[model samples]
Structures are given as structure tokens and as C-alpha cells.
Target: MSIQRRHTAQQLGDCFKVAAELALPVLGRQSRHLDGLTDIKLVHGIVSGQGKLSGLRFTHAWVEGLDDNGVKYVVDASNGREVALPSDLYYLIGEISPSECVRFTPEQARRHLLDAGHYGPWCGAPFEHEDPVPGVAA
Candidate 1:
């Protein structure tokens, strides 16, 4: 009998770490405004998979902000991706309180990644696992 091994998507800190670092300068200067609310400080959140990927959750980090016109935008520094914040995994971490900020170190970041079950080398594939459809393979 032969054993088959499947590959998973690649996990790198370039997107997450770099995005946070790059956005910090802008975040310090800008504030996001929501509909009926006053301007509020921007935040760094992890967007777990944005485009069309299978059921796999790949963590792509981005910063959320509002333009002067009150339009919301998500900025990705790794690729300079500016788009409207999707209604998906926008988890905010490193914030102790609404007014307090906690910058995550390399160790802390690794810990969170491990806790999320996303620490390790991946194959850069889209789907985390095969589709459930009958005999459908990715």
C-alpha cells in the first residue's frame, strides 16, 4: 500500500507583520468613521482568507480605516491591496482595552498563530482540505 501526502497553503509573516508595521504610520494619523458615529482610531485585524479559497483559513493581515468621505477601506501593505472591508474574519487582537494598545512581539505572535492552529509550513494551496462533493478533488 502507498501513502499519499497532501500539501497546504504557505504561511508567512510578511503579510501579517509587514501590514501591521506599514499601517502603523498611517494608523497613527487617521481615524475611521462609521455611519452615526464619530471618528474612531483605526485598528489592526487579521483577515482570515479574503478571495476564493476553499474552506482553508489563511491569515492575511490588514488595517481598517475610514477616508475623509466616511468610506471604510482595508489596506494591505504586503501587496498594497486597498479594498472595502469584507464581512468576514476581521478579528482584532493586541488591544487590551478600547483605549490601550498592546503591540505583539514575535513570540506573542507565534503563540497566537499556534493557538489558531495555523503555525507551520504550508503548500500555498487554496483549500485546507478536499471538497465534500462526491469525487471532487482540488
Candidate 2:
């Protein structure tokens, strides 16, 4: 058999670079809420970014943990807790192997956020997002 390169889901920054190269404006990454697959993602452009998120500036971030279904989850750095964020609360980073989903329901997992104890804080915070991207947001 011939060797083939695996096509892992691209990272948020990698996606950005791809977007920049291909000129495709919009793209979403797994948010820091689902777990680590691609359920929620980071949607950003090649310009300014969001400074305010849910009364927070998004000063910190971290990958929550993989849900039962394989979905990705992210968390806030400060509290070390998984947030009950909306499904559409996308982030600026892109996903790798995004198709994988969390096995459990969003509500159920959220209830166990504090108990699961898989929370963490990111050192490199999200920067300013670029202008609106294409094929991403309406």
C-alpha cells in the first residue's frame, strides 16, 4: 500500500493561515466548551477580535476535555470550570478531527462541570479577531 498523509482537522491558527492563503474568510474551530472535538468552535476573521465575551474579555482559555461522544469542550482559565456555553458559542481556533462529537448531551455534561474536574487555563489568550469572515457568520 502506498503511504498517505493523514488529514487531521486543522488547528484554529492553521485554519486561519489556510483562510489567509486561500482567501476564504470564515471558519469555525472547536470551542473551549464541548470537550475537544469540534462541537463548539472558534470563528474569527483575519482582522480585529472580540474583547468582550459574556461580560468577560476572554483573557484566558483551555480545552475542557473530550465528551463521551468525542466532542470537544473548552473552559475558562480563571475558574478551572467548564462553562455552560451555547452550542453556537464558537471560538477563534479551528478543530482537528472536528466530525467527532461528544457522546453525552450538552445539558447533562454541563451539570457535571464542577465535578468532572478536567478544567484548565490557557497561557496564550485569544487576540483580536479579524473582520467578518465568509461562509462563517451571517
Candidate 3:
């Protein structure tokens, strides 16, 4: 079956928060499925796609990892549902450029969060210097 495109009103601009939660066992939460994954990295970048966010380049975050078979996948929970797609497919659909992405390991992510005090576009990407959502601090 083909992967379905799903979006939720609540998840519109919460990509960073969702990604952080998924990548680290913060708030006493952990994704059990990620236990078997390897080389996991939290990524932040500008993304534009063909759905509600069509034609709009915005800061987004997600997790990337390799499965046991060594296939790379992009896992996103920003839509309020976890979706894992092949990294190439996800990048193509989101119009994301590898060179423009900022990646962090779980340890690095924790440090950044502690240093920046927020889930963020910490690398100062031209498109993302501030929080995407105002007053939310996520």
C-alpha cells in the first residue's frame, strides 16, 4: 500500500517540538520502535510541499535513521501521526536540500535544547532565525 498523506490542524507548526520528543526520551516519553534504529539524527531545515503548506518554505524538523537492513528513513510526527518514508522520497516531496539541513545526534540535540532553551533551527539557517510559532516557545 502507498503511504497516505496525513495532516492535522494541531500539528501545523509544531515540527520541532514533535521531532525533539521523538528523538530524545524527554518528558518521560520514549518511542520504543526507535530502539532498533541506528545512526539516528534530528534534522532541521526549510521545507515546502504540496499540501496545506504548499508553496511555503518554513522551518521544519524530523528524525532520520537507518533500519536494520541499512535503508535510510525519515520519520516525521509533525502531522500528529508518525510517518516514516524513504529519505529520498521525503526529501523530494518536501523540497528539502541535504546541504541546507542541520543535523544533530540525540546527545547534541539535548545540548542544543539546553543551550538554546527551545526546539529550534539552531544552526541559523537563513530561513529560520526565530521560532516558527509565537508565544509557544516550541
Give the top-scoring candidate (TM-score): 3
Of 2 and 3, the candidate ahead on lDDT is 3
lDDT of 1: 0.34
Per-model RMSD to reference: 13.9, 17.8, 6.6
Off by over 4 Å in 2: 1-59, 77-88, 92-138
Clashing pairs in 3: none
Q: What local distance difference test score does each model get?
A: 0.34, 0.28, 0.74
Highest-scoring model, lDDT: 3
Q: Which digits, one per residue and each the tens of the lDDT, describe model 1 over residues 36-58?
A: 32222223232334344333234
- Model 1 residue 42 lDDT score: 29
Q: Which ten residues in a row have the lowest lDDT in candidate 3?
A: 1-10
Query: What's the TM-score of each model vs. the native?
Result: 0.35, 0.23, 0.78
Error of 3 at 39 (Å): 0.9
- Candidate 3 structure quality by residue, lDDT tens digits, 15-73: 78778878887635456556678999999876775676576566678999999999889
Ten-residue region with minimum lDDT total, candidate 1: 93-102
Candidate 1's error at 30, in angstroms?
14
The CA root-mean-square deviation of candidate 1, after full C-alpha superposition on the true structure, stands at 13.9
